[model samples]
Target: LDPASGRWIEDKLPIYDFETLDDFERLKIFEKPLLAALSRKSFIGDVLGKPANERLYGSLAAAAIAVYKGAHIIRTHDVPETSDVVKLSGALRSRTSVVKEGRYEVSVLEVKTPQDAGIAMRNIGATKTGSEVMQEKSIHLVLKIKNLTTTEALIIKQEMLARGGDAALARDAVSHETETTDVLVMGTLLQFGRLARKLDGQARSLPLIAEMIRECISNRTNLEYRYLR
Candidate 1:
């Protein structure tokens, strides 16, 4: 018995859909161990009542709703069917839209020389190139820096901060306690483009890092790339 709620307790076999389940018994039956069994029974009954091909429609519908609502890692026995449903749901959710008013375009610029990169940077503006227009939007990026010392990680963080972006190092990176860590970079597309330009020809690893960022920005579905004059 629960002292606070004044509910009676009982020890009995778990049952589903009782005409009158005392509060304690109802709670116990709804627990994972008993509920799982009840769900299996219900699923089997649903399958038996439906045609062979239509047996999984209800389950697939539920899976689709879950995917559309941003649920990840759905567990199911129907992998092929569930995979198709999830893929379709994700494709629908990732659809992009254009606004006729107060709209901005995101582009990636690749320059070989510092002079060219500087010229590209100068073209970025609010109305001209949409630079600094995405103050309300921030892009999160993660990069795995294998075998980099803490000093190098700090340098990356500082460089990112100097470019109007921020970066977070893995635990103990500043204390010189970690040999390697994943760096999380947060910024808009404009900031990332500037960072990439800054990284070019700076170091062997930095150029590679810049390329990785460029590739990711290029592949993003939400953004369209255009050449800068």
Candidate 2:
């Protein structure tokens, strides 16, 4: 009878606690993610046996699976970067959380051109701040809009500033859209991945971030906007 049983079930599901695991037990559970991937027929290639390569792919596959299966936490030593990546990806429809299963989606409306997208995002107050020119759009806004609403963003900023430490305002934002399903206020596209990996990995403030974002916009081609409002 553990007090945290409820949380354990929700975050680490399928099983709660175990004293020990026999070889068979270990293999069975370990195969779940591989089987999960096999079920999708989404990937096919060389399955190597070397520990280094195999383990690397396994970790990535598991991480992908965890995201696919609605995992709430991930273990990593690079929390800042990882969390930054997570933050950006979750920017899409982040205004709300705790959605029904299979309800995640993003709306993308392709403007007539990249310039059109830039104008639209800037109208909403998004400042271009990225690593390179990922867009010709003057204001390529990448905002996390799912885990929180615009109102929540304001509240969070206020609370954090009031509490001390600038943790609320994002230096950069990204969206976590696996595909198009549940949403509004979008154009017509979806993206997912460790987005921070695309940046220079140096910025950590909002003011300088605006400059970084402009650099980012200057580095891309099909540059568009992830509007905040």
Candidate that scores best on TM-score: 1
User: What TM-score fits each model?
Assistant: 0.39, 0.18
Query: Model 2 — which ten-residue stretch has the worst lDDT?
Result: 16-25
Residue 70 in model 1: shift from native, Å? 10
Residues 35-73, candidate 2: write the lDDT tens digits: 121211112122233433234443444334433333344
What lDDT would candidate 1 get against the real structure? 0.51
As a TM-score, model 2 comes out at 0.18
What are the RMSDs of all candidates, in order?
21.3, 21.3
Query: How many pairs in model 1 have backbone atoms within 3 A of each other, for residues 3 or more apart or on separate chains, i.e. clashes?
Result: 0
The alpha-carbon deviation from the true structure for residue 104 of candidate 1, after best TM-score superposition, in angstroms, is: 26
lDDT of 1 at 117: 37
